[model samples]
Target: MTTISALTVPDERVLHRHELLALGYTPRRITAAVRDGSLVRVRRDRYVRPGTDRAVAAAVRIGGHLTCVSALAVLDPEIFVFAHDHVHVHADRQASRLRGPGVSHKHWRKSEAGDVRLSRRRLTEPPASRHLLAVGDIVGQLVRCLPEREVIATLDSLLHRRIVDEPFLREVFRALPARYRRIAERLDARAESGTESLLRLLLVELGIPFEVQVRIAGVGRVDFVIGGFLIIECDSKAHHEGWEKQRSDRRRDMKAAARGYCTLRILAEDMFHHPEAVREALLGLMAGHPRA
Candidate 1:
């Protein structure tokens, strides 16, 4: 009779410590398996089954989990892009020093809130108690957990607080989904990109028919276009660097302008910190050039 313990996927995570002991596999046995290339140690107490997805196998072997961006991607690759780094797992700080190569662990303190807690895929139980979450639940967990604005805020705060170095923050940011290209323009409003997101949102709210990220003829791409008549550009200082950038931007604007495209550039400060100004400017721009 094949028991649950006996059932093997070769790649499934080794769950509990007792499971390892139950197999009656001694260190000599493990060493022999390693020598034979049949077993690979993922962490100190973790061994991966050959031919399985390394991250999933690593997660299972460690009896922890793959969470954050990696989990998001595995759960919904379409929505959440994969981060090409260590599989992030919530683990004890002490156990990590003893972990094998390539397995990155993040310490979970009680101070952390809804952020890390959002992406936990419940450990699979026996068949009788299984209740899998829906696709919507997965997506919702990822989106609400991210909240682009919050990422920006965290970045800004990190600098302000001088708590950690930029390198660390960069790694953390790199582990996040860059942008939702599918709903980028519409959801921009939901993001902290302020001008870009808000302008897109307001235009949608105003029933403006516009194409996002449309490339212009003999000119660079515009942020969004209204009925092929007007071009909208959302400029945040975070994206623009210096005078050379200003000159390059002007050149692009000139090209669009020469093509009889009325261009409007909305700044980030104006869009978010002062939204009324954005509304007024957008309203004036729309009024002058009615969408045809």
Candidate 2:
């Protein structure tokens, strides 16, 4: 078996067979490297280093580019959102259907033919030769495809990361159908995670007036200050998993309570799974407190 280190080519983890041939690697040497487990065959023509990202490999296997929330999550895993349940790929409208347990194919539409071309022509940041969609196109597809609450969370994440500015996002919103335009208008960059964004959107729909990221005199900064004296804290396992964080959060809550603020801690699961329970609890609190 040939040594992979001996073959000098582009440094990218994922490489096309044609690229290797052009870089002076003979077919025999490439085959030997694959046999020796130095390279992994992701698809018929695509190869990647061992343990490459499954999502990218799936997209390449499907003969398309990653788009929508799948691309965004790959770009920034730190931003809290729902777990990416599948690999999302954008392919030609007439492309053959793809089959897999966790693969979702998004077919290009006739009306989006021009937009598709534009997305392909424009080079995305980091220059993803692995066939990831452009940021703009990804955002456009996300606004059109994802639910309203999810769209708000995604836009907030993009804005927080400065991936797309307000003006550019406004253009994306305008390009969407009229029904989705209002949803974009409700986006708040202050939302630190998808769960927080969803909670805020639900509160708005419930006609509850609340302040976000409010800094109380004793409490540093609360998630959502509702009805003036009610503080709603949204927590996730990522942020509040450890004992230290739990202790800190309890201290904050106690300090707020001492100052007449009723603090309610809402977990990520509560916000996503049992939203009705959350809504009913919020309504009860609002009714008792009455915004002062």
Candidate 1 on 75-161: residue-level lDDT in tens?
433321322354644332334332222333633332432222323433222211011122223222333455553333322322333
Over the full model, what C-alpha lDDT does candidate 1 score relative to the true structure? Answer: 0.50
**Model 1 deviation from the true structure expressed as Cα RMSD, one decimal place:** 13.5
- lDDT (CA) per prediction: 0.50, 0.70
The digit string of per-residue lDDT tens for model 2 on 132-219 reads 6656667767766667677788788766666666777776666666887787678787888777889989988998888999889978
Cα deviation of 79, candidate 1, in Å? 11
Flag regions of model 2 displaced more than 4 Å: 1-13, 22-24, 93-128, 290-292
TM-score of 1: 0.43
